[model samples]
Target chain A: MRLTYVFIAATMLLVHLSASGQSQEIPSVPLKALTGKHFDTVQFNERENPVILSFWATWCGPCLKELDAINDVYADWQEETGVELYAISTDDSRGIKRVKPLVNGKGWEFEVLLDENQDFQRKMNVVAMPTVLVVYKGKIIYQHTSYVPGSENKLYEKILEYSK
Target chain B: MVKKTGLLFLGLTLISNLSNAQISGSLESTGQRYVDDNKIQLDGEDAEHRYRSNSYLKLDYITGSWSFGVQGESYLPLSLLNYNPELKGVDIGTVYARYSNKKLGLDVTAGHFYEQFGSGLILRSWEDRQLGINNAILGGRVEYAPADALTFTFLGGRQRVGLGFDLSKGTLYGANIEAGLSDILAISTVDISFGLSYVGRYEDYEHRYLNGNNAHLVNSYSGRLSVSKGGFYSEIEYVHKGKDLLMNMGAPLIDGNKKAGNAFLLDLGYARKGLGVNASLRRMENMRFYSQHDLDGNVFNRGVVNYVPALTKQYDYALQNIYVYQAQPQYQTTPKIAAGEIGGQLDLYYKFKKNSALGGKYGTQVALNTSYWGGLDIEGDPETGMYTTKALGFGDKYYNDMAVEVRKKWSKNWSSVFMYLNQHYNRGYIEGKGGMVNATTATAETTYKFGKSQSIRMEGQHQWVKDNFKNWAAATVEYGLDQHWSFYVHDSYNYGLDKIHYYNLGASFSKNSSRVALSYGRQRGGLLCVGGVCRMVTEAAGFTLYVSTSF
Candidate 1:
């Protein structure tokens, strides 16, 4: 078993050296849209402009605040940068039922997907809620964790830098 | 010599092909150092270990349609207080390899995997580190999406219950199928979907109490339907479980105590633009199912086969969380012989338009939520262990909560949130002690942003209760130095009785996908919940360090 692990490690290292900066592709985990339609997250990379995936939950206070702040300026940002944002809810069965009503109640316009078992979250290596990532052509360019009061602006700045 | 040369060539070829693979992984470690304090003292084994840590590292390598991964975990010396004692030492916790082909409409996984079927009433295998519940299955799973509107899944495995791939004796098998009826029928006006699921658990018993009538297989089946048109939607689910042996205090009773279980859940919602309303009603009776029969009703929530979280409005403030509710789905005969619980919750969300009376210069968001739960009315003979319950009735009040919240932004630099809540918590029934306590709580939070990326937030909260822990007051202040750094100081005082101050101060730094946080504080011993699932944590004064990074 130890020798097998060594061999696997060597293969991973070789792959790492070859793939280097070109990897970081968005995983193709299966997901469900708020409308209950099947969705493949890999489709995110096929978009023309940079896409943002925000992992959040209905019960997380900071996540709500962050999304609300971004919602305020989302229209303007989209018109300017032609960017899109996907609010990926990691609410398991307990809270998954409330996500749609809450999102609609808040009047958020971003596309929403459900990660019922958090498979998409785990595949993305997200350890915490309110983790936002910027991807262009399936490759991650920027990411951030947690949220402060005025942190949305910094995120927008990164979006602008990547959009151009 | 010839075989060695062939093997070397094969290795070279494999290495060259894997060069196209991409690797991603994450690491998280949390360490704590306990301190001796007069107010809160550690006892027994807890005192023996002054330092403890829990760490996990996961690595995934993907190439085209094939991907592989492994998760290694370490709980050295000791894991965090309240964690499962079985989860000790370092070992490979989970391993998996998968092949997914979107074009072929097929996905297969061998090793450890997580899954959920139809709201997880019958089957759900997932992980929650905070709650110390990682019951992923170690076996095989296959998913086939033959068409855009139809999908089927099948799985069989043994549940992991401890560290280092430890598995439960009982074997689990499940099958599920979902169909989008609207799309198949070419109905454009409304959307309709349907699903069916079945889960079975098999275990061999060798105890003398067993009888010829006892069966090793326990089967559960579920049916679901959902319909939506425009902004209106509704979903309904029903589950029936075959008769199985009943357990009392983690031990199986006589075969005569075998009982069957069932559950019903309904959800309705309507939303558009600025207004949204949703309500959910659920009833569960003897619905607790576990991977291992002997491990039933365990404190660590291990070897669980389904997800049954409390349906309540999860609070954001510490005071509001004190009287949180946990789902009651077990049958008990001590003190009260109750079977299960029935309850529902309603939520309403409305946004006041901008430049209006309630909106001022900016819009204001208002949310109102309420929930109530009660025990199932059951009539039975304790000696015979036979019980009968009505389809719908409240035996005893378990919990109730009503809350209102408003969020507003006065300006670009200033924002605030205010909330008020009322609760009725039955301590005696829920926690096995004390009596009913009525409580009311209110909180206010305000944030002021200055400079380019700096902000300050202050919050005040107060809870009024006449029994069980009495009244409490708390306050918090957080300062953000920049986009990547922040500091916070929080204190919750039990002025009504204990006269103890649970003070905590913490700072965090984050850059990209990495975060580091350090804190020194007195942990308030109680149930710490995430996503409505909870774990009991002991009171302790300590310094904690947390670090996480992903690449």
Candidate 2:
């Protein structure tokens, strides 16, 4: 009973706090590509097209599942929704080397970016792997964490909703 | 407490008044209840605490280029293992305000923040809650990007010591600049980048040596270059640090002052449609970088400001990870500091053509890899923590590993993976056990799909070692029913000698944006690792729960 009471009180106190996601649509954080090029997320979506930013890593099992699911329908989703996906690898410097080889081996067709320093991950306040966010213009309209096979449908639906 | 409440109130006021503003946050909590068991005691861990919970809650308010946020963490009565004994009770993790303008190409951050420079060799301020570590800078940082091709950053802050802020430990200031040459040169196919960093740590204490008097300043410099074009890539970084005293972690602490720490790292790789190959080399000499100067130099705790991960391969197989490699920070566990280690690794991957005899309908992927590490050759005074070394001289082999793996997609419904590894580990030099360990590990895994939404996977692994638990074997099975529900059961046996069966069972469910998993098991815990940094997890029999969600 005491634990539950504390949880409730803390939740109430925390409900009043808000800042990270609601203020901007797309942050200006710089992410490194596998090819050593840097992609500024702010200027990445030049067309103002709906963007799907997915944060993941090499060692995350659920992330691979989510990416594989998205890959199955990515082309069709792009054709219909005019959306572009950026797979940001949250791997640290030690694991960054696996990015290119793994991506090529799996034949994933998304623009892969490396966050070796975790600067972007920290700025966005991402807490879990396979976190998917739907951004339009500069605002994050929908965000989801974790992964289930059917969850990809929800992401696609959010993309379609924001594309309108 | 008053400060925290004030910041929350200010954030709330801004959100309530601004229709154009937005606020969002996330929550993560893990709870464990321990039960006494004979096996845990046999593993030599004192289970004095019955319950432990670690939780974090964050809130952010943002509008346009301005943002502010606060983070709160609770270790409850005590933490699991009390990784940082001072990390108990409710506390504030970070509070910060930030502003970024894309048009002006400027960013400013004040309060608590995280930053890293050039691979974090010389400077890095960050957090890893799982490791019970958070060394974020508590001060101000400014970033200027006058052009698309060049960027500069300046920051000055005191490192977060233990659970709270300590001013007595002093401050660190750093400057970094990076040039994206490819962006300016308009090189369509080739990319090149260069970076330079300078970090100085200021501690006003009576050194009476090196620079003489108190107020010791340690300066470190790093330069990096990277080139990547399509499938070929190469990158290198070199770091040098000035003379300073530290609580030497590798040896018994008695005022271990070291001088001129340095390191070099290089990576090369190429990948194509069906092939990928990579090679990497690294050498470090007395390269222990820390923000604090008065620690007794014990591993895991004392608030390290930078992360120098073990440069060895990270394995996913349960048995292969047993004899893990930890970076020997200046010849671990000695009275006098000595040479650091040098090592290199090579990886090759090739996929067979589809419809080939071995590939069948889907191609088979074959991967081979090998890695070797050895102590640097050196002759230096140990009492002063000074050393000299030749790169790749290979004084004594500390670790060696070779492995081969094959992955095959047998059919639309089934897939399998097989792997084998051979390793030689110097237990005396690496794990500080005063001996040697030669081991071979083999593993097999398979997954079967049933219908559209169900699947089953199984794994079996075994390790043969001459020392410390002669042999070990484990088997795990997981069943996924529908897309949201999963169940798993596992058992590991030290059949070689201890002959103890460590058993576990768990289940999890995921829907939409949330996931909850609960497991009950006996953790004959030894070393638990993630991303090359490891800590010794205590043995215990417990029920554990993990929960997380995002907005």
Candidate 3:
């Protein structure tokens, strides 16, 4: 029995090591250079300003609300703390046509990127819509899933704290 | 030997550039154990165990203006992945190559890709892993944006079939155009957006059951408007589509005839300080949204939607969801089928704070929510055969719900919440495929936290009704050790609902990155309704284990 226990413990330790190894394997790719007319990437490490990368879909109600709330004060935030907000739309081709119109309809003035294939979503470990990630110098400082009415304000405060 | 040598050379090149590339993957597996009691079908084999597993690998290589990647997935137990056994070992995943430059954007995927058109009424290529749904298109896509607010896409491909099933011999072509009118118009407070799309498909079927054309066409249009100032915001969306509709009322009907449907959704909300209020109304007609034209023998291919209003009250209680409203396409015809037809739902939510001395150690927050859903009778009824011009106020079938929730935090590490719900469900209206009649239910739950890393949740729910299997009580206890490790146990007792109906207990353990759960309990078989569509799940004793993660 004791030997069996030892064997199990050893196997578990090996699994843990392998899992952690993958995290370390993340390549050091620069974000600023991911530029194309239809897509753009921002490096959290390269920017002195705090960064907000939000993953959303046009059909997701909570995601729309979160973006709308931020749009209301996005200009003010940009003026106050030089923050760069990047809204990534996970709208597949069927709904892709509405992204620009919806963004314009909301009067939102933020950088936008398209993850039509969910490539970035998978890389970022997004399980649900309206997932917000606050990054500073390429490191994820804070992350939150789902959104309530006033959650955007809390996120702004975190951004300010981190940027400072 | 030459091909192997070339692969070796490519592998060597990958290793040389390994320092600049990123590779990651994830694996998720689920297992189910079903125990059949001879209650429904006595004198037959009544127990089985099933297991399902799905995994994916993603690798990305980045260099300056270009990035390349591929994602591959495999599913087991053909049916679990919604695959027909006729086609074996045919994994329905994707592989792709992409290149982007300042002036051009190009994407070529040989395997599968999910696409959608505005609001997904006419087209929506998506995947819901939990539901084993993946509607990817195996094709190539290209996008061009000449201006900041305007974009366009051209795509051609074939839709994904079941896991391990080869793609059907069909081809689909589509295009989308989106523009922001606000950029050109002087709209300060009002934001307006519009989208237009067209999809054409060609099917090579051995047996053309529906229309002899062997070709399908769909046109979709969508628009949205929003106006916000101060703490008030209002937004509305409208979508319309024209395409072939498939109906399965028992006997399948392939309606190649042109059908049109539309939906309108409006939301208005206000919040300031600790107070919040929101109200919403939605009306939809003939909106059985699907991409395929000839979807025969597909159990879930019915396009009819269950209409439920987005009410402030949440029906999270298990009993409330048991007999919830589901959309029925067969009985509830859209305006296109019957003149002046309409269906809509309404919801309202409000929150309040308590500061009285009786509130004790901590202040309290309370919320109330209520919602109602019904259909409009516009034209002739099968029963009355009267074509009165006046519109019917509301259909006899409806769903009404009211709920209240309270929360309080005692110190930094402790918090608790209490909730109660009351619901009235119309079976005939909600469940299109008839079964039982109308029913009512009530439920309550509470949760408490011990610390940041440790917490416990408890729930008690009960329902009183006149139906044969109506009365029920349930309890659930859950403990969390950190965000990664947690365990939960729940049981429900249905007294005298049926001779075989008894109690069920289930437990689950999960880590942040992985999970394994086993449940052995008696599930009450009933109509699970959403939006107005209902699916019947059999009552059985079973255990299920599900695991998933990403690297």
Candidate 4:
């Protein structure tokens, strides 16, 4: 019976691999919004505008620093480039409680998503925390990992590049 | 025949849906070939399974508001050295079906799920592969929001203890309700919310010493209230537990009542413009509650019914992580005394002007953090299993840390970060090794961007201590080309411990959501931690490889 299950799993993997030849976008997964709504990654926008997804966790000190830096200039960036920033929290059940309180406390201005299982983070092949990636028109335009204090400015530059 | 047909039918249906649906998943496989190491034991006879591999394949099918996912894991022959051999095998790890409707304000998940309530002080169900812990409940969960201001969540199921389905069964169930008063009151000046949660765990079997009469059903309750207005915010949570007999009362021969346990947590923050300050405080006594009756906290963190972790800073630097504080989950059951802990942490962050004297070119960021925790002043008689404390009075200090960090960018292409940390760790009380050790660590990291798609980063760190591995130094350099290739070399030298050098060289390549890494390294055998949870990391000399891909 276990062998049967393995065969079925392998078959599914092969089938899915064949279908994965197309252009890459953000990983298609359902994550909860801070407002208790589930959002599909593929249906992000009505148009192919640039979308910046920054994967972070509450326990990650660098991630919070980067997010806080971006939060300071977030409004200006959004106004200029019309780029939507998704601060994706990869914190699981243990740290999920801190997310809401911290978000509200910090008064962040980005759309917050919960990847409690890290399904989206795993699909995106994020190797480390504080990974910021820009996706536009079904293609990954830019990605940067391991944020230093001033690394957020580089992310803004990439966002502007993709917005254009 | 019927089972095979059913599986085939399911596979075909999923495969057919893959043609049009947006299906994404990931596969991660980590393989290691171990060699004998002098520091960590590996050769006598138990090391027959010299090759260890841990692999996970996850598939998520998301169609609009509905999502179905499955995870399969394989630990061939043996799991990691830290992981129990009983968990070695290939099996379907988890499978779940979930549906969410924005219009109805409802979300539901069935089969297997993870959940938490209010900082996880009372309840938390999660999975951490590196820690070899996956306490995801095999059950059903529902979240409902009748209005935008109110939300309710409920879950009930047995926890997955080991690889198989029918092993050492235990049940965990919880429900939480939260309501935002400002939204319901139609006011914007003040934002207030309150939540209440109840969690219960039951297992038929109990430790022989603890006696089968140990409360078959244990309950924990939590209440939280949060208030935020303008730049000021504060949140508090209080948890109370019913009588739990599974707890060790100074070697299990206690005669009297082990009535209840309690914890109180408070978090306050104020952030406005470029300045932010936050503080957290917690007091807990006899709060190490588990689902089953196994002592010493179950290996791999399984059967943990509640989560209470260290409130100290989780440092990212290597040396800063050496003296990390772990929450005292279990009461100190020594012949001398028995007590819990009371502790807190404070953080202050400020940024200077971009062109100011202190800020230089890109601006300066200064962060100061301090945290400390100590055992409570309580005395317990083994015969009675009772203790008294001086009402929030702190006893001997268990651990404390002070840190300051400064970050500045010199130019568009160059950036630097410097950090210093001083820590005092009571190993006797915390880790049960050296008596007490004081350490100071300093680290400097620099990053230079060469071109639009090329960058190099390097870091140097050193720690000085008077005892226990007196001094340590680590250095790492990494070069990366935007999204395709990254190579890194790192070495950490322990000057005191036989002058061993833990070294590694690795490179990773990623394109369009798939990545593979190869490395040869020597790992230091010690306690590796994840979110305040600690597990043994065996010293190893090996060649390692990792592959992760998403489809």
Better by lDDT, candidate 4 or 3: 4
Share of native C-alpha contacts between chains A and B (below 8 angstroms) recovered by candidate 1 = 0.63
Q: Comparing to the true complex, what docking class would candidate 2 get?
A: acceptable
Interface RMSD of each: 6.1, 4.1, 11.5, 5.9
Interface RMSD (Cα, Å) for model 4? 5.9
Which digits, one per residue and each the tens of the lDDT, describe model 1 over residues B1-551? 22332343245346545586667778788999999788988999999998998988777777789988778787876788889977776677898999999899899999999999999989999988888889999999999988888989999999999987789989999999999999889898999999999999998866556665555899999999999999999999999988988777776666536899999999999989888899999999999999888888888888999889999988889899888899998888777578899999999999998899887888999999999999998897877667899898789999999999999999988999999999999989988889898999999999999998899999999999998889999999999999799999999999998999999999999998889999999999998988778888889999999999887
Error of 4 at B460 (Å): 1.3
lDDT of 1 by residue, A106-127 (tens): 9998999999899999999899
What lDDT, from 0 to 1, does candidate 1 have?
0.88
Candidate 2 per-residue C-alpha lDDT over B1-551 given as tens digits, one digit per residue, 9 for 90 to 100: 53544455454655556666666666778888887676665223435667888877776777778988877777777776637666677667788999989789899999888888987778777777788767888999999998877999999998777554543286889999999888888777788899999999887765434344332788889999998887898999999888755444433235444457788999999998678888888888767766766553445545465567776667776778778887764543353345588888888777776799887886777778888888877765655555566765777788889989887777766878899999988877776666778999999988787765677889999999877879999999988776578899998888998888888899987654467889998886677778777887766788999887654
Q: Order the candidate numbers by lDDT, best to worst.
A: 1, 2, 4, 3
> What is the TM-score ranking, best to worst?
1, 2, 4, 3
Question: What TM-score would every model get versus the actual structure?
Answer: 0.95, 0.90, 0.70, 0.88
**On DockQ, who's better, 2 or 4?**
2
Compared with the true structure, what per-residue lDDT tens digits does model 2 show for residues A1-164?
A: 54455555455544544333244445567877777666787764455678888999877766866785687578999889789998999888777787787677666778899988787776676877778877777766777766644567667777887775
Question: In DockQ terms, which candidate is top?
Answer: 1
Per-residue alpha-carbon lDDT of candidate 4 for residues B1-551, written as tens digits (9 for 90 to 100) = 32433464367456656565555556778888877666545765457878888877776666667777777777876676678667777777777898988679789999878777877888877777778878778889999988866889999998777774533366787999978887888777887888899998887764455544566788889999988887777889999988876245333444424557889898887766567788888898878877665533655677777777777766777777777778885665563465578988888777776678886766677777888888888877655656777767888888999999887777767778899999999888876667888999999998787765687889999999988878999999988776467888999899976698888899987654466789988877777888768876667787888876655
Instruction: Give the clash count for model 3.
Output: 24
Cα displacement (Å) at residue A137, model 2: 6.0
Stretches off by above 4 angstroms in model 4 are: A1-43, A46-48, A58-80, A91-164, B1-14, B17-20, B37-41, B63-65, B166-168, B206-212, B249-257
